[model samples]
Target: MEITIEDLPGHTKASLSGRFDTTGAIAIELPFNTLANERRALVIDLSNVTFMSSYGIRVLLRGGKIAMSKGAKLVIFCPDTAVSKVLTRAGTSDLIPVYPTLSAATAAVS
Candidate 1:
């Protein structure tokens, strides 16, 4: 997977692309962790993501736990493709809260 980090006004958004599996999840975890420290709410954009595995959802849940502990939120946007469906099938959507778009995710977090 390819992750592009963006420093938003009061949040950090990570735009993810490609497949996110156990192997790719390892590489992406570091960047995701670094971005988590940026703001109270961490936004993950999955619009460009093509696929995701349960391992991917596990990575996300870890970050989500960290954010929650810090009184921060982890919001996911563009859960339209297979990536998002994987999360949904993994039962992470209720745990992390998935939104339709970036704006909606940001707005909900704000």
Candidate 2:
């Protein structure tokens, strides 16, 4: 997976590309957690993510917990239908908010 981070007005945006399977989760776990730990507001862009697995859900849940513990916010935006279904079915969409747009995601975290 490819992860690109950008600093926005009131939040940090992390754009993820490639499959969010086990390998992808491992590839991004550390850095993603680091951002969750450090940033007060983190908005993840899932527009480019092609697939997701249980491992990906784990990473997101962990990140969300880490951010919450730090009194921070972490949200995802622009997940395509496939990815969105995975998240929804896994019940992660309830724990971590998912927005339809970057602006909505950023505004939520802000």
Candidate 3:
């Protein structure tokens, strides 16, 4: 996976691309942790993520927990249909609201 993080006022947005499998999940751990520590809210843009595995879901859940513990929120935006299915089936969508648009995702935490 490739991650590009942008810091916005009161929140951060990370744009991710490629397959979000075990390797991809591993690659993002540190950056996610950093963002969780620094921001009041996070928005993960997954529009370019072609696939998502259980490991990927774990990464998101872990990050979300960390953010919550720090009094922050984590949201995901624009995941592909396949990735959305995995998140929904895993029940992660309920835990961390998934938005179909950037505006909606940003608004949720704003």
Candidate 4:
């Protein structure tokens, strides 16, 4: 997996590609947690992600909770159907809003 973070005016955008499995989750935990701890709105772009595991859901949940507690927003964008199904089945989609487009995701957090 690859994680690329970008700074937006009011928030941070993290673009993720490849599989979001245990290894991938571990790889991004530090950076992702750090960003969440910053207490700023966050946009996670999952358009390029091909797969998502339960571990990935856990990481996202943790980040979302931390961000929410700090009054920061966290939204996901463009997850592939497979990953989207995983999130929805895991009820993660309910906790973190997922948008079909980057514009929509950013708008929601903004």
lDDT scores of the candidates, listed in order: 0.82, 0.92, 0.88, 0.88
| TM-score head-to-head 1 vs 4, winner | 4
Distance from true location, Cα of 79 in model 1, Å: 3.5
Ranking by TM-score: 2, 4, 3, 1
| C-alpha lDDT of residue 71 in model 1 | 86
Each prediction's RMSD to truth: 1.4, 0.9, 1.2, 1.1
lDDT of 3: 0.88
TM-scores, each model vs. reference: 0.90, 0.96, 0.93, 0.94
**Which 10 successive residues of model 3 have the least lDDT summed?**
78-87
Best by TM-score: 2
lDDT tens string, model 1, 1-110?
Answer: 89998877877788888778888888799878766654687889888877788788888888888888888888999657766777787789989989987889988877
> On a 0 to 100 scale, what is the lDDT of residue 35 in model 1?
68
Q: For candidate 3, lDDT tens digit of each residue in 1-110?
A: 88998988977899999999999889987887787777888899999999899889988888889989998888999745888888888999999899988999999989
Worst 10 residues of 2 by lDDT: 78-87
lDDT of 2 by residue, 1-110 (tens): 99999987888999999999999999999999999999999999999999999999999999999999999999999645899999988899999999988778988988
**What's the CA error at residue 87 for candidate 4, in Å?**
0.7
Instruction: For model 3, name the residue pairs that clash.
Output: none
**TM-score between candidate 1 and the true structure:** 0.90
